[model samples]
Target: MHAALNAAQRTLVREIATLGTESGVGLYIVGGFVRDLLLGGAVREVDLVVEGDAIGFTQTVFSRLGGRVTPHRRFGTAKWRLPRELATACGWTVLDFVMARSESYARPAALPVVKRAAIRDDLLRRDFTINTLAICLDAERAGVTLDFCGGAADLQQRLINVLHPRSFEDDPTRMLRAVRFAERLGCELAPATLQLIEPARAHVAALSGDRLRHELQLVFEEKHSANVLTRLNGFSLLAAIHPALANTADAWLADKLIAAEAAGAAAEVCWLLWLYRLPAAESRLVAQRLRLPVRLTAALQQAQQLGAQRNLGRKLASSEIVSVLAGVQDWALAALVIAAQDEQVRTNLQRYRNDLRYIKPLVTGHVLRARGLAAGPQYAKVLARLRDAWLDGEIHDAAGELALLDRLLLQR
Candidate 1:
């Protein structure tokens, strides 16, 4: 397990272990970092648990490591901040620290009240059994496995199980996470855990918009996000989040999501693409419910309007395509090209993205003014005519553009 770390990570871990031993406190690598290590995947983040005042320990790290320490006293946590350049030179993680703590929720879906506790208590409080496993970082006990929750066994069995029956109830967002982990790991939800999802469906609506939206964003981030959404839809979980999402037509969704993935669309674009087929009003309702940024909500509505246009399927000149799509959100255009079936629509969208939108008349407003043409409605008319000529392949260069300009100015 120690061999999995790169040279810089090894150096930092050794230093942290030395500090923890001298201080007489236990420190362990915990959660996703350990889980990914067991899975033989490249670990992306490193989280550390200290059986001591994590804030103070983080200050110690800052004093010794020459980085900023941002401590959160209320949460018993601190971030060892490092400059990007320094972090890459030293390690992937600057060593984020959290107290090994237990949590109790007064009500379902409420944030947990926490108390500092041993590593065993902390492991039990996590979302999934797979994530409950940890590895000791203390030098004498380095690489020791701590699995009070049978997390390692579950990991071996390729199953996802909650630590307790009330797991999803206490935090509804875990339902989404459960799906995410199960799908990502190619594991199945334990039968006991699968049955609990139905009841949790009722509580999903109570979650804050930010929480639910953030979970959905993670879903889109997955490589096989289409499959995840399919599972969510089958469970009616998507509908529980929003009625408009209730029936996105699985086949259509799969196709567009695949195309979106192929296009390397951002999560925000993926989001709008998911809602691309919804009625404008329902799409707006979902956006409002999720509290999506106003720009995205507006893009969702505009994508529907633009996608609904019947004329897009017909062959059109480049300038005409621009006219139809002018001022449309780039996100909307991106979503449309993925959702569009007509070859002409896709071709025109590509043309506009790559060429038409950026094509300016060689004869500019300045040139028009220099020619003694007043800057008014006629200036716009002549420029539009000149540009259309350029779009239609009537003009190829500045010389052709000048001739077109003369004809346009004469007509004006």
Candidate 2:
């Protein structure tokens, strides 16, 4: 773990350790950083906990380290953002510092009321045992592991266990988190922990949309997202988020997602594919629940419309293809192209994506004005004709386009 630190990070960590030691404050690295390091997974986030005033600790750190510290006094937490030069050198910017604290929820899915407490109490409030593991960062004890819970045992046993039964009750969002950790860590939820899920299922509805959407985004960013999603569905957590998501056959969407990603489609296209199994109205409802960006919502709708069209064929001229697909967002067309089952349909969509969609008239409104055509709807007609001729291979060169334009003008 010490070797995992880059030179700059090593310097920063050592400085923090020295400062903590001099101040006689207990300091440790907590949460996912310790968990992943112990699991031999690559660690990125650095979460530190202090058994003292975390904001005061930050001021001390800032004086010694010459960096900015953002202290949230209400939460007994601070963010120590490194000086830019050091941050640039290390490729890591901010370190989270928190006072050891305990929490109690007033109601299901309510934000916790936090109180400063001992490290053990702080560990007790964590969602999972594995995440409760901490590593001492004092100068004399820089590598000591602290386990107030049997987190190490659970890690060795490859199990995901809640610290207490009410964990999911307090925050049903952990139900989704449980699936993520289990799938990501290659662990199974302890059977007793699994038993606690059903009763708290309804509380999943009480979670804020941002929290649920953030968790779903993490799932999609996972290397084995499909597996995580399938596991989530098995728990009926998907139904808790939205009935539309639950009704969209898990296996079908999973298969399409796998195929779409295999084609190297962009994330936007992949998202539409996730919404592909739903009816237009249900898709919008799911999008609304997830708070998908306006662009993605629009693309999903356009992709649905494309699904209903049967006229696109390989035999369609490039001009015909553009006419049919015109004004459809490029991302929507890409999703349509990826979803198409027929080779001919895929080919036609691919041509537009790769080549034909970029075809444009050599003659512009400016050129038309110079040619003595009045500035009115006639300009649009002439440009469209020129563009179509180019798209249909009727005008292969700039000279051919101009000649065609001149002849069209004479005919007009």
Q: Report the number of the highest-lDDT candidate.
A: 1
- Give the residue spans of candidate 2 off by over 4 A: 16-26, 50-85, 247-249, 264-268, 360-385, 402-412
Root-mean-square deviation of every model: 2.9, 3.3
| Cα lDDT computed for each candidate against the true fold | 0.86, 0.85
Candidate 1 stretches with Cα past 4 Å from truth are: 22-25, 67-69, 90-95, 361-389, 399-412
Q: Write the per-residue lDDT of candidate 1 for residues 1-412, one digit (tens) a residue.
A: 6668777778878888888888778999998988888889888788999998898887777777777888888779999887576588766646689999999999888878999999999999999999988899887889898988888889889999998999999999998898889899989999999999998888888888988989998999988888899888888899999888996738888888888888899877889878887777787788888889889888888888887788888889888988888788899889888888888889888888878888878777889999889878988778877878888888899999888777766776
Tens digit per residue, CA lDDT, model 2, 233-344: 8888889999877745366667766776677766677677777768888888888887888887888888888778788755798888888887888878877776777888
Highest TM-score: give the candidate number: 1
340: Cα error in model 2, Å: 2.6
So what's the TM-score on candidate 1?
A: 0.89
TM-score of each: 0.89, 0.85
What's each prediction's clash count? Answer: 0, 0
